[model samples]
Target chain A: MLEIKNLSARIGDKEILRGVTLSVPDGEIHAIMGPNGAGKSTLSYVLSGRDGYEVTGGEAIYNGQDILALTPEARAAAGIFLAFQYPVELPGVGNANFMRTALNAVKRARGEAELDAVAFLKLARAALKKLSMQDDMLKRNVNVGFSGGEKKRNEVLQMALLQPGLAILDETDSGLDIDALKIVAEGVNALRSETFSALVITHYQRLLDYIVPDKVHVLAAGKIVRSGGPELALELEARGYAGLEAA
Target chain B: MTALPTQRLESWRYTDLRALNAMSFAEAPAASLPDGLPDIGVPRLVFVNGRFDEAASSALPFARNFAAVDEVSDLPLARINAEHAHDGVTLEIPDGVDAGVVLLVSYANGGALHPRHRVSLGAGAALTLLEVVKGDGVYWHNPVTDIVLAQGASLAHYRLQDESQEAFHLATIRATVAADAAYESFTAVMGAKLSRAEFHVELTGAKAHTHLNAAQLLGGSQHGDFTSVVRHKAPDCSSRQTVKSVLCDSARGVFQGRIEVERVAQKTDGYQMSQALLLSPTAEMDIKPELQIYADDVKCSHGATIGALDEEQVFYLRSRGIPEDTARSMLIRAFLTEALEPVTHEGAHALFEAAIETWWARK
Candidate 1:
């Protein structure tokens, strides 16, 4: 489970997330729908402990522990995963090697035995298959030349491998085609379980059609203006947030 | 060993090796020579004090076509300051002989340790050369290496510079590549108080390929300079140069890479990139990548970046549960991976990686 309490964040001198609060329980998928500059990505970044973003107020708690004080890798070790809106390209670093290092780092933090090269390769191959990704992707540099959809799927692949307690997908549906979206959604759907939770950050309800969120929170400006059942996504998609200012 | 030459010496123009003469470099510890060296050897020629040590070196049996020398009487020494100019070793590969891993080890220490090595691969031959340079005690090391690759030959050379911090080091590597030949060189400098390395490559033949990569990690008051010049005299050759420098504390680093292409060398492709990461605010670095291309049809590009650590990446790793120091080390390790790629020997790669990690721990 993850909790955000009055999380206020800013970049430079401008405020981004102003008194935003949300929570996602185990086995639940929460959707945050907002227009451009709604602080959607900023929320994900702040949660993942990115630098240069000032957290002026409140805190984020994950799995009964304060996460705001943790480093990014610490948050990751604590089972907080963020599928970046844009996957960074690490040249000369093999994709599988990076994934394995990340997995082992988290695993070691959780008191789990580290996986060797063979075992890591097997697990990575299985995860790639589940995500409908090719095995050749394992040999290339991390996201060096990956397609946009491939990068999104790779993010899911990492999430599945790390088996994070809370996974945040930041605009993962942006560049995915219909098939790729379906595959990505299937990857997420397959990872759904009683102990898993996710925050799906997106602008449209198209992805919701496949993943099917249990709760939808409309985030405007910085705060979550409305929280409702799955039907909230459809309502927002039809009516748009143009009228939400008065609400 | 002789005393340091006066400042009037032309060779010591930019730097004064005499500054180290005042400090009494303690006697060098006895070395129990390498035990059971691997037979995975190629054509090897060893040098000590900038001169060939024949008794300590071995040559291939019935060496006919290839030219192997145990001594060179006429030394064309360049940097002769004072009366102490030492001799060096030289080796030449005959045409049409493809040699495997050629390991050249140079040991320098005490007083003035100057060694010179000359390597020439004949036409259509392929060779791999590795130069390992290190020493103990406070000493001065000034080693020079010359390599000539004839037409259609390929050469790969790697240098590992690990000297004592109390030592002053100066090394120059000059290479010439002929038509259709390929030359690759990599240098990793990890120690020394004032270590300066110069790399010069002259591409004299058409369709020759040249690549150079260097990584210099400096801490304490260590000073490292990787100055290089690559010339494209003929057309259709490709060249790539990348230098990465990491400086900590009061350490100083410099990267001056110049690439030149003559007007006749059309269709030349040359690229150069240099990046410096300063861990401490007091750490200093000077990176200058120059391109002087006379050929209008050549594609020449260069870039230099100097900055502190990437806070975003650092935080990303830290938030992943890695400690602050560990995160910085990981990023630095990743940054160095690019320079270490040319090392084909996995064991050597691991050794270099461990050295980098050890240096990071000291930071």
Candidate 2:
């Protein structure tokens, strides 16, 4: 469902994601493991069309359509979701209002009937229950005063609500504890289907144990150095990135 | 209205009232009036060019002829109201009575108008007051309101000043709260070419509370000023003042707020904040928030912020699929919510909320 070829990007004078390429077919989850500054987050930002990320070269395609040419919002309407590594704090904007507006916007773009306040609240409450979040969370400002784990879970909540065709998880497991990791993994695991696909980006193999990936790609020096089955993650865990770099 | 204070004057330095000297004024004939008052069975008092029209007003028990001039009148406009204001209203709420609502409407019919209103609430009384000022054509609207809240009494006042585009509006209010009394007021300004609203509030007795909240939205060449002085004179009294201004195009706004805690006013808590959002590069705002505390055991703070739209917040909303314009509007509306939240009347809140949206949409 998603493909990238010769993807190269940079910020200002420094180059990141130099000639990186990978593909995640429909119904499959691909894991990208890299050390700090391995252009992992840059890849997510580029896919989501974040500003200041100059796309030097390469092409990213989603569902046989060019994803690089669309605006961030348009990409969202086309079923592309990016769970930001650090969710921004939106003061005075309620979480429930944000989600409902987002859901309605995407629905309108897809030519579907939009949900009113009553229907929207019902759907949101059910989603919150599934995610083990309290109902009062909807009343608070978006991500303000939320714990690190709660922020990640909120992102997962958004993914569940948006139900995008392709989701880019950018370091979502970094700050989460063990329980939070499982809840996040369960939330993603629950969405496993023939049509749903995700790119699990992380530096450790611990997350792989929970949301076992169909494919593993070791990203180093801004490129995919190796691609293998799930066992590849375990091998990398035994030998750190430094050991692999030496070899 | 013609004299502009030079920069040497502290309070009126940036606001040049003399700019209004060039506009010609005319006597606005009594014409059709708009539905400016809310429908809450509020006894209505209508004034045209400072004269009460018996045909257009419904009498309340306190409606009476103007008394002699007040010795406290300081400015030329206040003195003008004291000398010329006719058919003024004096609303007195009896002890322990819940006087529902009282509506005061002042229309500057293309000429100089001075409408004086006095409101007094007896012990244990409660009331909600709506005061609206508007007019058509070139006119001068000078209104003075004095309020006294007795012990344990409470009052909620909503002031909507939306004069015509060619109109000049200057309003002054003085209020005093007795022991354990509560005074709350919210003002929303959307009209007038040159307008100034001044408030002087005093917490006179122990355990008193006062809150003054305002939101001013303007575009074009319009100018607005919200100046207020709040004094905490009694022990354990608290005061809060919040002002939000949105200026677009070449519009200019000003906020001058002074909070004072006297020596005997121990345990006083006072807060003042003024924030302005400039939508255009040329749009300007001048804010001066001051705190004077002679009391040793008191807590008082003041803050002022002048900024444009937060780009990160804008992008955050845009990424959620809300259009760029819609996202900006939402953020602007949210910014005004803090000032509007303290407004107690349901009808008045909805009305002013709609006016804010309409102002932004009009831009």
Candidate 3:
């Protein structure tokens, strides 16, 4: 569903992603793991079309079209969702308003019927119930005073509400504890389907144990050095990136 | 001889004095009212050039008095008003009565209109006052309002200033509060070439509470200023001041707030915060906060923040499929709402929020 070839990105004077090429087929979930400077987050941002990142030499194709040429909102409407490493806290913007705007926008772009307040509340309450969160969360400001797990769950709630075709979760598992990790994994797991695909970005194999992936790729200094089955995550956790670098 | 405030004074640092020296500032004519005003089904007091029109205004069912403007202020514009004020409107609320919405409108053109007014709340009385200043041409609108709240009385004052782009506006409000009285004021500054709204509040009785919430939205070369002074003379009184401004183009915004606690005002809790959002590189904001405390046991603090639209938040919103303009509007509204949240009266809150929405739409 998504294709990237010869992706090179740079921010200012430093080059982050250099000649990285990767792809994920429809109905398959993939994982990207690497060291600190492995350009894991850069790959996600490059795919999501964030500003200030100069794509020096790369073309990202999503659903057979060049996604890099599209604006960030266009990419999102085209079914690309990026769960940021750190969610922003909008002080006075209510969660319900943000979710409604986002959901209606995506739905409108996809030629689907938009939901009004009442209809939107019903749908949102269902999703909140699935996440075991209260209805009061919708009244509060977006991510304002929310715990780390709650913020991550809010991101997932957004993803579930928007129902994007492709999701890039960057470092979503970094700060989650066991219970949070289980809920987060369950949230992603619940969305698994033939039409949906996710690019799970993480540093450890802990998340892989819950939300098993079809394929795992080792990203080093911006390039995909190795591609293997789920066992690659366990192997990397055991021997570290040094084992892969030596190979 | 008491000296009128001028550019030489520290309080009028950024505003120019030469401009005021040039204007004739003659008493303006009684121009007609505007075509549209909010339909809140309340008593309306309409004024033209500071003169009350008995034929146009509704019959006064309650109590009212019109006297010569006499009280003088150290501010230059207040002095000007004292020297030449046209008429005044005083609405005194009786005990335990909840006066709905009182709409006060002032219209002017090519002149200085000084309207002095007073609002005295009886014990346990409540009121919501909507004061609107709007007009055209090159006029100077100077208004003074005195508010006194009796024991356990409460008042919600909403001030909406939408003057001509070529006009000048200067207004001052001095208020006193009794024991357990609640005073909440919200001002939305949207128009005027040069405008200043000064609020001086004194908590005279113990356990009184006061909230001064204001929002200023200016674009182009417009200038808006909100200067306030809050004094606590009684014990256990609390005061909160939140002022937010959004300046675009070369618009300039100024916020000066001061809080003073006397020795008898122990356990006084005062908090003041001023924030500005500059949408353009040339937009300027000057914020000054002061706290004077003779009570060692009092708790008082003030803070100020000035910044441009956060790029990260913008990007995050856009990444979620919201357009840039919508994202900007959301952030600006959020910024303003943070300061406007304290407005309790539904009518005044909606009016203030509507003014903000209109400013956002125009900008």
Could you say which candidate leads in TM-score? 3
Cα lDDT, all candidates? 0.78, 0.84, 0.87
lDDT for each residue of candidate 3 in B138-212, tens digit (9 for 90 to 100):
888888888999999999888889888888888989899999999998888998999999999999999999999
What fraction of the true Cα-Cα contacts (under 8 Å, chains A to B) does candidate 3 also have?
0.76
Leading candidate by DockQ = 3
Indicate the residue-level lDDT of A129 in model 2: 95
Ranking by TM-score: 3, 2, 1
- Cand. 3 TM to true fold: 0.95
Candidate 3 per-residue C-alpha lDDT over A1-247 given as tens digits, one digit per residue, 9 for 90 to 100: 9988999999998899989888898888999999999899989898988888999997889999999998888899999999988999998899999999988877787788999999999999999999888899899999999999989988988988888889999999988888888888888999899999999999999999998999999998878999999999999999899856545
Model 3: residues with Cα > 4 Å off, grouped in runs? A243-247, B1-4, B53-56, B63-65
Instruction: After the best TM-score superposition of candidate 2, give how far the Cα of residue B268 lies from its true spot, in angstroms.
Output: 1.4
Which structure is stronger by lDDT: 2 or 3? Answer: 3
Give candidate 2's TM-score.
0.92
Give the true-contact fraction for every prediction, in order. Answer: 0.45, 0.42, 0.76
Give Cα distance to truth, residue B111, candidate 3, Å. 2.2
Candidate 2 structure lDDT:
0.84
DockQ of each: 0.43, 0.54, 0.76
Worst 10 residues of 3 chain A by lDDT: A238-247
Shift in Å, residue A126, candidate 3: 0.4
Against the native chain B, each candidate's TM-score is: 0.83, 0.92, 0.95
Error of 3 at B120 (Å): 1.4
Q: The CA-based lDDT of model 3 is what?
A: 0.87
